[model samples]
Structures are given as C-alpha cells and as structure tokens.
Target: MITYRLLHPEILAGLAAAGHGAQVLIADALYPHSTGVPAPAARVHLNLRPGLVAARDVLEVVADTVHIEAAVYMADADGGESEPVREYRGLLGSHRHGGDQEVAWSGLERTDFYAACRRPDVCMLVATGETRPYANLLLRIGVP
Candidate 1:
C-alpha cells in the first residue's frame, strides 16, 4: 500500500516518468483539458466535484514530490489581474530550494498558457475541479 499523500496511480506514473525542464500542468476545473493539451501527455482528472480539490492542493503534492524549477500562472492580458495568481506567486516564493534551484513565477497570457501546453516538452496534465478563474498552473521540474 502507498503511504504518500498522493496515491493516485496516474499522477504517480506521470511524476515518475518526468525529468528536469519537463512541464506538468495542474489545470482548473473550467480549463479545457480535452482540447488544450496534446495526446502524448498523460491527463489525470482529479476534479471529482466542484472545489473538491483545488489547484493549490494538487500543487502542494506535486511540489513535494518533484523538484520544481519554475512555475507559470495565467494572467489577464489587459491587466485586469487575478487574486489567485497573486496568492500562488506568494506561495511559490515562500518555498526555498538549494543552490541553483529557485522557484519563480512568470505570468503568461491565457492563450500563451494554452500554446505552452501543446509543446512536446509537456509530460503530464492534472485537471482539478477548482472553480476559481485563473487558477490553472504550469510547473517546470528541476533536478533532484
């Protein structure tokens, strides 16, 4: 039996196969999982119910298991902004890593975020039932 917090089989498998610089997306409930991501990347749906599991909830688990070099959050193109994005940036900043391992946030447009998910480097996608707008996240794995 597994003792870790994240016991989901697909999430475990995806993390095990991922390496440094590989991208893993933790998408919000409303994000279009089917059409946004490519076919090759593993897609795990943890969104059982509305707000049952938030993006941050999944982020904490993924952060614990993987070496995260950088993180990207969706932003408003017209500068309308998002509270969740601000909170997420703060959360990532509070985490400290060893030499050459830094956690930083880069704001990407909604379209840009979608474009990035289509890249060949993306390894997996976790779709959570987070109803908050702009709650989507993209994590870049680092060397362990």
Candidate 2:
C-alpha cells in the first residue's frame, strides 16, 4: 500500500539504510558494476533490455526519494566531454526540490568516477540498460 512513486523493495531498503553524504550510483549498461564496485552494498538491476530503463529514469526516481547534494558524471575517457553529461546536466536543471534543497552537478574524470564509487560510503548501485556513452551518475544524498 505504498503511495510513493518508488516501490522497488531493494531500492527502498538501501535508501533507508543510507545516511547523509552516502553515495548512490546509477550506472549505464557499459559501466563495470561487478569489479568496479564491490557487492553487499545492494544492487538493483533495472536493465531489462537495451534502452529499457534509462539512467535518467532511475535518476528521477532516486531524486524523488532523496535530497541530492551533488551529482557526479563521467567525463569522456578519451580526453573529451561527453554528450551524456550534457543531457544529465539538463535533467538536473529540471529536477524539482520540495524544500530549500539544491542539486548540483559536477564532472569527474572517468577514472576518478570509478575510484569514487569504490569508496565504502556508497550504499547501492542501480545498473540500468542504458546504451548511451558516459551515462553513469553518482549522487550524494543531502540531509533533509
């Protein structure tokens, strides 16, 4: 009898367990979830098919549940900017906050992003079947 938009049990559990400053990774299909980030933090695979559940879709849901302090996007590994980053920035601009909260977007090097995800503070990872390059995003939860 949940009234919220997000109904996934695992996602809800992870969010509940997570504290402020904890990170949640919403990754693309190409992102290496197995070795890049360790398990036991909880992972929800919404990647039903290619382009089935996009990273943006999951981002929207996660945003609704948590107050995002900052967002990190992967820069092109080939030493250039990524289109996905542009789209992600646009989405962040349109994201609505109920109270006096703000969501900021930040860019990180591809390697740096991978390294950050390895931190022990990351609570969960959602692997979506998005095929777009550099579609991965890391969100830091803010206190309400």
Candidate 3:
C-alpha cells in the first residue's frame, strides 16, 4: 500500500530510478515537454486541463518524496522574481513537511532553464496543468 500522497505509478517509478544529483522538472502547462528535456528523461503528464493541477502541488509532493539539493526557477526577462518563484522559495526554504533543510536555489533565464533541462542529469519531467506564468521548477535530488 502507498504510504505517501504521491501515488502516481509512473512518477513513483521514475523517482525510484533516480539518484542523488539527478534532476526533476515540474513545469507549467505552457512548457514544451516533448522537447524540453533529454530523451532519456522519464515523462509524466499531469496536465488534465487548465489549472487542473498546479506546479506547486507537484513540487510539494516531489519534495516530500526526495531530498532536494537545489531548485532552479525559470526567470522573467526583466530579472525579477515572480509570485510563483517567491512561493516556491518559501516552501523550499523552511523545514516544512517535505523539505528538512533550506535548499540552495537560483533563477535562470527562460532559454537557460530550458538548456539546463536538456542535460542528461534530468531523470524526470512532470508537466503540470498550472496556468500561472513562470511557474516552472527544476529540482536536483540529494541524499536522504
């Protein structure tokens, strides 16, 4: 029986196959899932409909499932931290339900973020139904 909130089989399996230093991308609906990450990366589509699922929701569950070493956000061109980025920081910074330590985090330009995702270290890509702009988050797994 499942003991945690993250019950999706594919997601669970993908995460299970990943190890420390592996990356996971939980992105908004607008993200280009098909071509964003490398070919070896496992893909899970939770985009049922507009706003059906939120990136933050996925992040919360993923954080609970894995020890996140770092979080990378897709930044705005103006180099400003968006609302979603602030919320992500608050969630990842505190010793909350999912995260036990303050995570090392940063922001990357859209292209830079996408390029980062294309790297082979990304083991999973979860495309959410979040409608908010700049709601994407990329996580690097750490030791439990």
Candidate 4:
C-alpha cells in the first residue's frame, strides 16, 4: 500500500505525468472545471456533496505531495479576504516560488483568474465540494 495520504489513483497518475512549472488547480464547487480549463487537462471530482470535501483539504494533500512554486486564488468580489484565501495564504506561507525565490502568490480578478487557469500549463483540476465563495486556487509545481 502507498504510505502517502494521496492515495487516489487518478491523482497519482495525473501528478506523475506533470512536471515542474505545470499547474494544478484545487477548484471550489462554483468554479468551472470543464470549459474554464483546457480540454486536455485531467479532472478529478471530489464534490460528492456540499461541504463534504473542501478545496482546502485537497490543497493540503496536494501541498504535501508536491513542491509548490506559486499560488493564485480567485479574488473575492468585495475586495476582502475570504475564509479560504486566508487559509491558503497561511498554508502556503513559506514557499519560495520560481528561480528568484519570490513569494509566488496572487489574488486574481474574476475574468483574469479564468483566463490564467485556461492555459495549457495547467495539468489537472481537482473539483472539490467546498461551498464557500471565491475558494478556487491554482498552484504551480516546483522541482524536487
């Protein structure tokens, strides 16, 4: 048996195929998984029901498994920090992104967020059952 908490076969396979600089999105229930992202990207649906599986939970496991270089969250419409964004910021607090060692984090505008996630660099999108608004998050994989 695998010792890692990330036991999902599809998740393992998708992450294995992706390399450094490849993006992974832990999307909330409201985020568009199909049309918002590229057609070739791997999709994992953990959204069995509302609040059953949080985007934060997925993010935690993914962070443990991969070296994250960057983090981007969909900004709240009111220009205030949402619950998930706060949690994400705290969780990804220490990661030094890219070759420059900069804190690779951004709160993206609504339309811009969708566009960034749609790029071919995204390898997988994990659709969670989180109910909170503006909880979608994007991450860039770093080198081992």
Candidate 4 local lDDT, 1-144, one digit each (tens): 899899999989989998989999899999887887899999999999999699888888888788888888888998666889999888777554454564478888889999999999999999999999999998999975
Worst 10 residues of 1 by lDDT: 93-102
lDDT of 3 by residue, 16-127 (tens): 9998899999989999999999998999999999997888888888887888888899997687778888888888775332336668889999999999999999999999
Give the Cα error of residue 50 in candidate 2, in Å: 0.7
Residue by residue across 25-117, what tens digits does model 1's lDDT show?
A: 999999999877888999999999999788888888887787788888888656444777776776777564555556977878888889988
User: Quick one: RMSD of model 1?
Assistant: 1.7
- CA RMSD, predictions in order: 1.7, 2.0, 2.1, 2.0
lDDT of each: 0.83, 0.83, 0.88, 0.87
Candidate 3 residue pairs that clash: none
Kindly give the number of clashing pairs for every candidate. Answer: 0, 0, 0, 0
Best by lDDT: 3
RMSD of 3: 2.1
Give the lowest summed-lDDT range of ten residues in model 2: 93-102
Q: Which ten residues in a row have the lowest lDDT in candidate 3?
A: 93-102
lDDT of 2 at 109: 88
TM-scores, one per candidate = 0.90, 0.89, 0.93, 0.92
C-alpha positional error of residue 110 in candidate 4 after TM-score superposition, expressed in Å: 0.7
Q: Between which residue pairs do clashes occur in model 2?
A: none
What would you estimate as the lDDT of candidate 4?
0.87
